[model samples]
Target: MPAPTSDLASFAIALAEELPGSWTTEHHTHAQYPDQFDRAQHVWDMNLVAHAIAEHVLGQDAALTRDDGTRLYVVARPRHGEEFLIGAIAPSGIPAEAFRTVREPDGIAVPDDPVQAAADITVDLLPRYDKALAQVHDNAARLATTPAPELVVITLTGRDFHVSKPERADAVQVLLANGCVFDKDQGAFVLPGGDTAAQSEAIQNTAAQLSRLGVGLTVQPSRTTPALDTAPATAPPRTTAPAARTR
Candidate 1:
């Protein structure tokens, strides 16, 4: 089996990156029949099988329809194990499927041909894929509303301050609107000058807004805060008490 062309591979990578979850290249070892000499071919065959299942059983269109209206395309990403993340760009949004555990016939002779194998696998797996996609959508929605931990970290860097882990998109936007410029090379948001008071106010406002949106913020301790390091004064030793006890 031939590997996916460079163009197809690039498109898949871009699509996967655009989506919310982490995705990796689809490798032959990740295929159901890893021992097969033509692993890429097997994957391609499986993709075709999945597309057919989507059309016939799931009532979905091909991942990609060519301008010529002759050929269709499907791209897939491999997870750590048997799961394959498959999708195609659509007019409205991405139509995707996740195949983790595929159903197979009981004691029926599985065909050696890749196309037939894909068909068999698809028949069992398509339903599972639909269910998984639904669950993924639900989880994503829940995560959006659920309060995240203090993922953003703010650190004082020389005369400026840098913000790290700005996980929330809205929080980043707030920071940017309030004069925080993202340093692409450093992968952080930088606030210029040593105006501690002004910086503090900005940080507070950003935190408050993000908190309202269920996003968390963590501010690094400022070195200028001597008060934080100062311990309460200990009482002087009772020298007079010692003399009185001796007398």
Candidate 2:
């Protein structure tokens, strides 16, 4: 029912498809950076990503929130397989263990080798995660250059849906078995740890919880907060930060 904070990949996909006007880009800041691989550069890059998502995906003064009181916000980067930090938002703000979490403390029964057990734990799932990571990469590419004004991060924030990608779907199944929270909205597994059913249940429970949080189902007004700097008139509106650009 609340907005998704951990669902950055969705935002990235949306940004790639939406956003408007020409925008600039830069790097992120890092901690130990006297050179190109410096942390400062990383931080700078992340900021640019945040800007891109804010301007391109969400559009002007647009954002979404669900009912369970889960809040979603726009940011520059959502954690993915380290390709481009091209700005995004996630709906975390679902903790790692928000859904069903399984602990491997007793240790999974498998060959004594740690590598084998770990591999066995996800022998069928590695490919899925890899593919999902790849999709995220593709999404990053699209968001960087998309030129649309009405950006909307499309995602199914509920249960009973399936990832179209085979590998990703497999990984979701595996991760669910491993106690990871595979958020349908976020796509990335909430490995605190996530898996398939957790992912499914997150959406279902979220919808159910959000139902009663509404003010008689009349639609709440936007919470104009987060912006703080002078920006382009067309820039996404922000309360304490810039709002993602949308219609």
Candidate 3:
């Protein structure tokens, strides 16, 4: 794909979120057929990815496919240390029917075609999505005053996982930390779980950890933290629906 205007770092980070969504939309379409990863097609795909981000047309899974013998997953950091989307389900012993879907807040839906949907985010939509996202988060924080979740999760990428720079925080990251306890070392969240009184010690630990950065760890609880799925990276289906897309 063509090099989009997005910075390399931001673009790469966006992939963790985008690929899953786009895969869902492109899952069944022959548009991104494995055979089409040609030089020119590659450029086109890159451009589409950039356009999706620019347009805020963030589908849950845009390009995912669950066909005969293929599935995809994010396996590792490759040559550029860029996360590689490994479409290697067959060799990896995964079923091909694993990847397929684009989700709306309402439900899972498949995209018709990507080529037709490829459009840049208009200047208006970019700020609009950003502003709306910010407001939802603000509301969530306001609501946090009543009941607290078991966790307020934030997934961090890049070497600075410790989240040292306050301004560098993703808007979601800030929301998760707002009006809550925190810790960086454990890399786990202790967000107002159950009774905040019981977690006072854990909360202190979390607060201390957040004061500085450190290696990956859960600061909040000792329980296992989960990784996003290869498909849409969504929690398991809420009800019977189409197959979730991943990778």
Candidate 4:
């Protein structure tokens, strides 16, 4: 069968399509051997596959069948410019009685349909994208409760306020979320609106929040000096009255 994309889900599906029945999937990087079995045997086989791949072997396929009819199909393929060895073990032929004594979870689920088995494997192997989305939602909810900063200008001119340098990054993030903009020229953040009592209150509240983070927003005179003209001055040109125009 043609190789699938580097995505683990697609890889699982491709491996499933090549299989004849429900089988457990295994990878060299994400190997989860059954605890009930002798893990050393599986690890040895896994190492063999890895060694072959490291030697630049491609399209290598092999099968191992136990006396009980349980079989393992190992295949090596290149993934993301690196070779990876994957295996699928068919344990359907083995009698369920063989595992009756093991009360612990096998952790590997093999659905009757190979496709579903692959889907299950994919779900287990992939990162928790849903968890990440929920985290983003939580952050948004928290930001929504933060006071919307007043955009008016503060009364202090030629003065700028800043948090402690070490905490600038985190403080900047909080200020920006509350509708503040960084003024590179002023070397400090400028609120979107200012010049009212509300502006002063907003600054005080923001400062208070930053204080909890061990940083204080304090005002200081602008350190940037105005540029001086270095060029020599020229005399102003004398202008004569325009000649009288003919009627």
Candidate 5:
């Protein structure tokens, strides 16, 4: 016979109350493959693991799905004779899943005291939860700072052009090889200046070269020296530009 509905409902009620969330329950039955003995055996073994020690005591296993779609399985026969074990059956693909326990040895045990277990789990996981959240924020910050190939600034100083640093090492070397000097005072790579027509041509050629190599350049008069034109670097262009001539 299936486990008493009252017993399942009672356990779910206790956990839901402790967690204080909208939760719904479902009867979980192990899938059987009558035509395939090996498959059936494998599923049975997996179910045994999923149900934990509660298989024999509960006579049936069940799951609780939160309003947010996170599922926690019921372990009726918790080790140490605890009343029930509420834990994830699989990774829920959510932040909570990172610290939420399972039925494994390393997983947190849900004792008879559902309220206390909930509190303890919160306390135990707070640091890790905060850390996980922090890591996500840190990654976003890194992405925000990533170089924008399209915003490569080329400022026309009195004589030469002051170019902002490109993130690529190869791009840096290319600039250095083409008679560019790193000016510490200006914090930009200085390109030699010449006749107006020749300088314009050279700048355009260099810009095109950089563009081919997945970099961009924006030429502006030196009056805008203090700020480098910048934008969030998106994925490089898919189509190739014609081979750029060395300046």
Candidate 6:
């Protein structure tokens, strides 16, 4: 189907979902009658019917059509409290008075106006999206200030654990979540002596989280390995655009 027609179909379905009452699509066939109508003529007649339905029943300015030259119609019965009944003019070569009543599927009630319905759905989903974004930002910030592996060393004399040059936000969130604290004077994440098991577990958890976020960890040289000059890296600043207001 042409892109515009496809888009119209999508729009119709979305609109239908929001409107009150049930909706159904019907295609009229004239094959049963012996009088063979010209295809072009039939399409023209159907277009007229579609326009009438859109204007009188749907209260819309224009009719929506498909790529196959089929006229689209939305048939609905407005509920008890509704001002007007919703129904469609079938393309069965019959008069609009001969319109048939189709069953409406159960659906959520929506506002009478299509634009208002769309706005309602947008309002409902925004808070969830904002919460997820906030979480991502927090995680990113934590990773940026974390210490590197080479800097994570235990001094033999004091048994003080140190983490150096931690740069990834995700990594830092994992460490912080797993009970690691920063030491300003030592310039590292310090885990006091006698908690080797807990320290190891924290490191392992940080590695797992970093892997999930697609961030690579820098391995720093410890007492056993030669220390490399690893520089601390900062996460890029993030900015969020304000949500557009509904007028």
Per-residue lDDT tens digits for candidate 2, residues 1-247, read 2222333344333432232322222223322111211111111111233223322322212122223321122233322322223211222222111111111011122222223323443443223333433444454455447532211111221112222211333333543553444566855444231244454344333333323332010000112311233223444333232222210
Instruction: Give candidate 1's root-mean-square deviation (CA, Å).
Output: 25.5
Q: Best candidate, TM-score-wise?
A: 5
For every model in order, what is the number of clashing pairs?
0, 68, 38, 8, 1, 12
* 3 against 6, candidate with superior TM-score: 6
TM-score of each: 0.30, 0.20, 0.18, 0.23, 0.32, 0.25
TM-score of 5: 0.32
Order candidates by TM-score, high to low. 5, 1, 6, 4, 2, 3
| Runs off by more than 4 Å, candidate 1 | 1-150, 221-247
The CA lDDT of each predicted structure is: 0.37, 0.27, 0.26, 0.35, 0.45, 0.33
User: Model 5, range 113-158, lDDT digits (tens) per residue?
Assistant: 6566556545653334345445534534554465534345665443
Model 1 lDDT-worst window of ten = 238-247
Error of 5 at 205 (Å): 53
Q: Candidate 6 on 1-247: residue-level lDDT in tens?
A: 1122222234455554453344433333322111111221122111222122212212122123433322323222222232111222123333211111111111122234455543543454223333433443454456447532322222221233454435666566665786767888867676554564565455556555655665443221121111112111321122232221110
Candidates 5 and 6: which is better by lDDT? 5
- Badly placed stretches (over 4 Å) of model 6 are 1-158, 218-247
- Pick the lDDT winner: 5
Residue 112 deviation, candidate 5, in Å? 1.9
Candidate 2 lDDT (Cα, 0 to 1): 0.27
Candidate 5 residue spans exceeding 4 A from truth: 1-6, 29-58, 91-106, 125-247
**Mind giving the per-residue lDDT tens digits that candidate 1 earns over 118-215?**
35434553344445445545544555466435456555433466777466677788889767898889888897644656765676677677667755
**77-148, model 4: which lDDT tens digit per residue?**
433233334332313322222211111111232333334544653564212322332343453455446542
